[model samples]
Target: MKRVLLSAFSLLMCMSASAGVTFNPDKVKAVYIVRFANFIHWPQESSLKQINYCVIGNNQVTNLLESILVQHQVRNIPVVFRQVNNQEELDDCQLVYLTPESCRLGELKIDRLGLVTVSDERAFSESMGMVEFREKSGRIVPVINVDNVAKNNITIRSQLLRISKIISTPQGVEHD
Candidate 1:
């Protein structure tokens, strides 16, 4: 099993390299968001035609995400990119990538809409987002606030939870 998995990963890396995608932080961040979408489950009644991958205040990452989406699908659902401009535009987004400048849009409204928020912005998971990507020792670490995920009625598979840094509370206080 391990050998098969390793082989598949190697083949994927080779394909990525051949496709002109060199390993970089921006590309990694975009890939991470795409992978996260596969591991999270939205509410059952919220039918999806395509996964709406939204980005705010960053076009470079958005472009990178667009490239990755061309080769992948979230749970076999087609992904469409949306470069969002404001909070109101996020209503139908299933996944969102935010920068610190656009972090203000990572509000309770996102949770209510069942959006899986991922960001590299510091303290993003502690504030209102579900996942924050932090760089540690030359690797990007995903910090996840499972509480926020649950509040949004989304279920992240335990396999993903096991690999992430889990925090149950935000700001050292439990949610009311």
Candidate 2:
């Protein structure tokens, strides 16, 4: 099962890479944003009403996700998209995606309440967040920081861990 998932992920990476530079990055990212919600296990304490997705900066990615996920449900939970223009917006989101232009870890309080973080920054899993979407070989792939993920009290599915390059290096990413 692990191998199968890994191969599927590799195929996706290859396909994404082969896609021309004109490929809509936001669209692909939106697909992944939704998938992440499906693959991760949020804390049981989370509200069952909906899955809150916090978008910080990158209005293009934010808008794309909002449009795509508005009608979708992950694990039977309605996926709600919310814009994070300030720290106060971070209070209620379960998933957080920080655009490349968004503020870095030091400048913001991301560790609050075990937020599952995803970012476009390079090796973000190693220092800035749990999952990172990096462009490699002309493809966008996800890397996960296992240690960081555990620290947040979140459990990463083996399928996702299989496809993701797990890193444990500490580059100053903090948590509560």
Candidate 3:
């Protein structure tokens, strides 16, 4: 099962590279964002017409994700990327990608529900975010805050949890 997931991820990377776009960390992060939507179960996912991937700021990864979503989806629901500045705009967002600046600006304190917050900002997972992309051995690793996911009534499949660095709470990290 792990191999299957890995292959699917590799295929996504290959697909993006084949599109004449150069492979970069942003591209990998974008791919992970897409895969994350699949691994995590959102409330009323099937009832939604589409999945909204909200970004707190305009950046390369957001652009790459927009392009990637043009060809991919979450459980047949088309994934759309939107630039969101405040909590009001994040209402229908199933997932949100935060920028480093957003983190530094205390945006992490947002007490929103039903949103899987993600970021590449270091220690973000420890700071109440749902997931943080950490660079390890030149690869991007997902550090998931299981507590936060549960807080929002979201569930990350065991398959994904098994492969990720799980944080049982905001102050600690535990391996699956």
Candidate 4:
């Protein structure tokens, strides 16, 4: 009986590991944002004619995100990946993943556009949208800035809201 219990425990551990996000903590958070993209609704005027995923300043995370997104389709749209060097390239992206080093540039662009911005850094909070990842009690969890999202005219689905730790902000304070 003890041997059987041990086997069961081992099985549980393996399953738990497999069930968790596959990338490293930071990269997993970026991938998580990719998944979150499916749950957001852009205004009719929003430029979603093509689904583009941009990565700024962190090639590693971009590579991992590309691998993950390759297997999934969003709104029947094929995902396209791009590495951005400047804010001017941001206009075509529906989702932008910013590394710590590029957070300021991303923030500046997101503030001017209605694009979804995600980052693993705290400085991202000043942007129009953010998907902040943090390690808590040895686990990685996403904290979403729904207020920022709304400010950008991006609507987050209720289901995603339920699963994420949402950061609330006052209504009407969100700039266009």
lDDT (10s digit) by residue, model 1, range 1-176 = 33443454344334444467554666556666766765788885247888888888775667877766664555567778888876799887888888767775544356574788888888888878889987765456678887888888889888778767888754724322
Query: Candidate 2's residue-wise lDDT over 25-54, tens digit each?
Result: 665666677778767887753566888898
lDDT (tens digit, per residue) of candidate 3 on 39-100: 88887776888888889987888888787676456667778888888878888798999888
Best by lDDT: 3
- Tens-place lDDT per residue, model 4, 144-173, is 776677777888888777756776554323
* TM-score for candidate 2, residues paired by index: 0.80
Better of 1 and 3 by lDDT: 3
Ranking by lDDT: 3, 2, 1, 4
> Relative to the unseen true structure, what is the C-alpha lDDT of residue 21 in candidate 1, on a scale of 0 to 100?
56
Model 4 residue runs over 4 Å out of place are: 1-23, 45-47, 104-107, 126-128, 169-176
Instruction: List the candidate 3 regions with Cα displacement exceeding 4 Å.
Output: 1-8, 11-23, 107-109
Q: What is the C-alpha RMSD, rounded to one decimal, of candidate 1?
A: 5.8
lDDT of each: 0.72, 0.72, 0.78, 0.64
- Mind sharing the TM-score for model 4? 0.73
- Candidate 4 overall lDDT versus native: 0.64
Candidate number that wins on TM-score, 3 or 4: 3
What is the Å distance of residue 77 in model 3 from its true position? 1.2
| Reference-based TM-score of each model | 0.78, 0.80, 0.83, 0.73
Which residue segments of model 2 deviate by more than 4 Å? 1-22, 171-176
Cα displacement (angstroms), candidate 1, residue 26, comes to 1.7
